[model samples]
Structures are given as structure tokens and as C-alpha cells.
Target: MAARSRRMTLPSLAGRIDPIYKPATKPTSDPAHSAAFIFLHGLGDDAEGLENIADQFQKNDKVSYMHWVIPNAMEDRDAMTTAWYRPSPLTAFAPSRPELEEEEDEQGLVKSAAYVESLIDACVRKGIPPNRIVLGGFSQGCALSLFTDLTSKKYSGRLAGIVGLCGYLPLAGGSQLQHLRAIAELPPTHGDVPIFLARGKGDSLIPKRIWNITLKGLEAFDASSVEQHEYEGGHTINGPMLRDVCNWLEKVVPKLED
Candidate 1:
């Protein structure tokens, strides 16, 4: 109701990727943007998949001042479609046994993490600090978003919050993840940042065992700021779910003037 949506292309560290950027309708402090949310899409999807979300929020005057940056994932060479990382069966990504877990796409994860950081840097350059920025995604995007936020040395524990929709955590356990935590220097209070995680009741894309592991993994970090939800439908975003996310956003990123 207050701003117009436009197409944008931001250069990514992983490769030359075109991202859809939606500027906030009004600034929290006149002329200087207040808060931003850098949201990524799921595997086999691009920026368009999540662009409406920005529109959904901007229509509500409460969050019109929040900027939204949605980036596109490069087309997977093997899958022949857009993806944030190497194309792998989501079911296999997080298995029950650590020894039997699928080998993660470390290269893709690292590069994408760098790309996410670049997006954060872009927002920071625009005057928005890390504490005012929230990163989130759906499905594969959720996995990458959480993973990136968790491992990126520059942003771990510095973000305002994270929004993860219908996705499982990857590389959740083992000495490797611990090694990564050490490298990132995440503190015991890393859980201080709020999180919004949701799952579908009838969804088959994410198995029960893997989802449990995801919860367990988040607990390992003492992520007590989590608020999880479950919808009646399947692995798709619904109106109720969006409403819940919007409400969560209201709690995490309140009006600066308030």
C-alpha cells in the first residue's frame, strides 16, 4: 500500500546471480532505512518463489519500513534448475545415523555462505546493521539460510532473527559441526537470537526422523529462542503459515519509533 516492487540484480560471490530486491516503502528514520530481511528460496526455485512475501508484508503498514532482499539461486548443472547448493536428495541430506548421513556439498555450502555474507554486507553498506537484519528461507533455502547464518564468521549470533519454513537442518551433528562452531566462534548465548521454524503436518518431503534431528541439532547450540509451528497441510506455504510468520516478524523486528 505504501511502496512499489521492482526487479533487481545483485552480484553474488558464488557467481553472477541476479536477485530480486524490494526496497522498503518508508524509512524508520527518514532517509535512512531501518531494518532488512534477506530471504532465500528453496531448491529448484528462484527469487520469484518468495517475492510475494515482501509484497505481503509491505501491504501491512506495520512492516512497510522493513526492506526485503530476495536472491536467486544459480541453475543446478545436474538438476537443470535453480538451487542454492549442489542438487541432492533432501531425504538423504540428514539421515538418522551420522555415519550413514549423506556427504554434504561442502564446496557449495561454503560458497553460498560467502554469497549470503555478501548480501548482508550489501545491506550493512546501505546503513542497516547486522542486528537489524533477519535472514530466512524455505525448504532448501531454509537449510542454506540456517546453515549459512550458523557458520558465517561475520554474522553468527549478530543477526536479528531467522525464519525457516518447512526444512531440515543439514550437517547437524558430529565433530565436523563442532569444528565449524569453533571456527565461527559462536558463543554459548548464540541461542539468544530468535528463530521461527515451522513444519507441515501432512508433508512427506521432510521425514519425521530428519526433522527430529533438526530440532536436536538446534538444541545442541542451546537455541532457546526458537518458536516452532505446524500446519495442517503439506510442504507448501499457506495463508495461515504466512500469517504466523508475519506475527513472528512483528515480535522480532518491532517498529523503531516504538
Candidate 2:
């Protein structure tokens, strides 16, 4: 067995927030073993919070070869918690509420998208190709992941898949929405990047109506390439969802060695 290389960097942001990303994991013994999963934590969570989920996959023989990269969101609050961005004013800083008024510039959306792009670039520098990378996040992190997947101009080349847990797609009628629509029109450069969306059936944060809207938007954008699953729970993740995620990864990621 060989030692793996891990690197970390903090990138500057426009506002007070600065994004910190973990370096890619390079398998020391097997340089050729290359696949990566980037996990983004939701509001009130830090990069270290997702370690349990990553550890779950590490126990899986089928996914042992994969490298996990969990990035901390830039907008840290209370000197302890982090969030993709400040909650929209319309929602009154509560994700459980809906934004009655639309944003003028989609500032939060754009900022978060840029932060994700920075993380991707860091991965590229550390030797992970886009095709072998799986972008995923939970809750608010899911929102950022979806926004990046839809708006990124550089998202075309290579991608393994995208997984969103208890998340919804970005709302329509903005620059972000337009970019997503345009990306949908173009031929998929990654050959139907598999999408897995799982939400708790009783999630009050992302109500049933919002989930329906998310599905509808995906459908409208020709995102028929999605897989949706619902669990009987609330805002938190459960064992079944984790198991399903692993199953999906087995189908999407390349095979691992014994």
C-alpha cells in the first residue's frame, strides 16, 4: 500500500466570506486509481461534519478507491457555522419559508456558483478530471451544487454524477435560471450526467410543493436524466438514503480494487 497525498487551500472571496477547500486525495500505491467525490455541507454545518458520510462509503468495498473531498462553505456564521450564502430576505432567513419577492440580481446564487467553480478548479490542479468527479451536497449545499451544475460554463467536459440530498433546484426568472435553460439546450458533453435527488417526505424546510417545482423545472429543462427518491422522515438524513446513495455510486463510479 502507498500513502495518499492530501492538500488544502483557502481561496479569497469578494465579500467577507472566503472559501476553504480540502486538497484532492492521491492514492500513493496506485496512482492510476482516480475518482473523486466532492461533498458540500449545508447551512450550519462545517466541512468536518460530512466525514461520517464519507466514512460510510469508505467501508464499502466497491467504493474504496474513490477519493472524498468535502469543502467548507465560505460564509461562516457565529464563528462556528457555515452556509452557502445568507438566506434570501424574502424567506426571512429561514429555509423553511418561501421567498415571496424575487431577487433583483441573484447575488447569492452567483456568489455560491463562483465558490463551487473555485473548488472544481482546485480539484483539476490536484489531478482529478471532471468526468471522474461527483458533485454533491446536503440541503443548502444541494442548492449550491444544483446552481453550479446548471450555470457553470465549464461543466460540459467530464462528470461522474451529481447527488442532492433534501434540496431543490434554483428558482426561475433570473440570470441563473437563464443559464440553466441554455445549458439544457446544448448537447450534454458528459453523456447524461446521472442525477440523484433524495428528500425526506416530511421535510418542512423543503416542502412538497417546492419539491414538485424542482421536478417540474428539471423536466422543463430536459433534465429527464434524474432519479428521485423520497424517505419517510424530516429534514435530517437517514440510513435508507445513505444506502441508496451508495448503491447509486456503485452504478456510476468506476470499479475499485480489492
Candidate 3:
């Protein structure tokens, strides 16, 4: 056994951001067989709040090949709450303002993006191959994950999958899409990275129309690589959704001990 490792949180982006992560327990002692799942939390939530959810995978005999990572958002709000970046309205078409700007910071977005990129580099350094890593998040975290996937040049290699929960792509309007196209296109990493997007049918903040737009934009890249699911509830995760996520992992991740 390669000495049972402990959780570690590291700083990134010139110390502007931090991410909390737990190394996956290897089913065996093989270093090359390990995988990682990076989890990003929603707005107003911190790494500690989501760490418990990551711990859920610890019990699965099939999950030992994977590590769970929860990256803390850049901005910390009242008490222990955190956010990746300030979220604006989905677009002009979004319903209600929905308290998007309690503390808006543009520079924070740049810093946050840099922080996430650094975290990915850290994962590679930790001996987990890029192709075996899955990046995921809830709400605001999902938005950041999508943005990072599309923008980061480092994402070209070793990206296995991306999971977005109750989130939408930040770029709106054709001009922004054109800019994204000029920089890079969707399914950015590996040319065939699988993407899973899950949302609640009753989510008031992220309405069905917004999800529709996201799906449309993703389809522009590689429709086959994108998969979407809608649950019955609102603005939160449910049991079936978790099961679906686990199943998705089983399919994408290699070397899972049956």
C-alpha cells in the first residue's frame, strides 16, 4: 500500500485562490491506476460545507480508485460562506434579478480562473493522470467549471469529463460566442471529453429556458459528447441525481475495481 494519504489544500494563482482536496484511496497499490474528482461548490458555500458530500464517495468499494477534491471559492462572504466569482443575471432574458450581486468583483474572476488552472496543474503533479480526472461543481461552481473548460489552454490534455449541476454557461450573446470560438471551441479538451449537466425542473433561479440555451451552445461543439438530465425538485441535488452521477463516473473512469 502506498502510505494512506491525507487531505491537503493548496494555494494557486499567485496565492490568490485556494482549493481543498482529498486524495482517492487506491483499491490497490498501483500509482498509475488512481483517479480524481474535483468538486466545486455553489455560491455562498465554502469548501467545508461541500467536503461532507465528497466524503459520501469514500464508502463505495468502486470509488477507491478516485479522489474527491473540493476547491474553496475565491471570495469569502459573511462567516464561512464562499463564492467562485460574483454571478450576474443569466442574461437579459432571465427571470428576476435573484440577488446576483451581493458583492461583485471583476478582478476576482481573473484571480479565480487562475486559481482553478493552478489546481488542475496540482492534480497532475500529484500523480493523477489528466485523462482520469473529472471536474464538477454545483451552481456557481458549475459556471466556473464551464468557463475554465472553455478558456484554459492547459485543458487540452488529460481532461476526462466535466459535470455541471444547476449551472449555465456565463457567455451570452453572439459576440461573446464568437470570441469564445476565436479562443477555443466547446468540448475543448481531448476533442471528445464527456460532459454531464443536471438541473432541477423546478429551479426558479435557473429556469428551463436558460438550460435550453446551455444545451444549444454545447451542441454547437459536439452534441454527442454532451448529456443532460432534469430532476423533479428545485435548486438542489437529489438522491437519483447522485446515483446518476455515480453511474456516469463508472462509465468514464478507467481501472475501477469491480
Q: How do all models score by TM-score?
A: 0.88, 0.78, 0.81
lDDT of 1 by residue, 49-105 (tens): 888878877877647778888887877786678877775555634456757646777
lDDT of 3: 0.69
How far off is model 2, as Cα RMSD? 5.4
Full-model lDDT for every candidate: 0.78, 0.68, 0.69
Which 10 consecutive residues of model 3 have the lowest summed lDDT?
1-10
Q: After superposition, which runs of candidate 3 have C-alpha atoms over 4 Å from their true positions?
A: 1-9, 12-18, 76-81, 91-110, 177-190, 256-258
Candidate 1 off by > 4 Å: 1-15, 30-33, 92-101
**Which pairs clash in model 3?**
24-67, 130-158
Clashes of each: 0, 4, 2
lDDT of 2 by residue, 142-246 (tens): 877776776677863257788999987766433457655375564433246788999998888888777876787666656656999999998888999999988
> lDDT-based ranking, best first?
1, 3, 2
> Which stretches in model 2 have alpha-carbon errors above 4 Å?
1-33, 60-62, 76-81, 89-105, 173-176, 179-191, 256-258
TM-score winner among the candidates? 1
lDDT per residue, candidate 3, 1-258, as tens digits? Answer: 121225433444342334555666654365446777888888887677777666776766556678776776654553245677766555426446545533334455556767777777766776667888788889988877776666566774247888999988666323454354456543432256788899999898888878887787766555367888999999997888988988898888867444
Model 2 TM-score? Answer: 0.78
Arrange candidates by TM-score, descending. 1, 3, 2
Each prediction's RMSD to truth = 3.8, 5.4, 5.0
| Winner on lDDT (2 vs 3) | 3
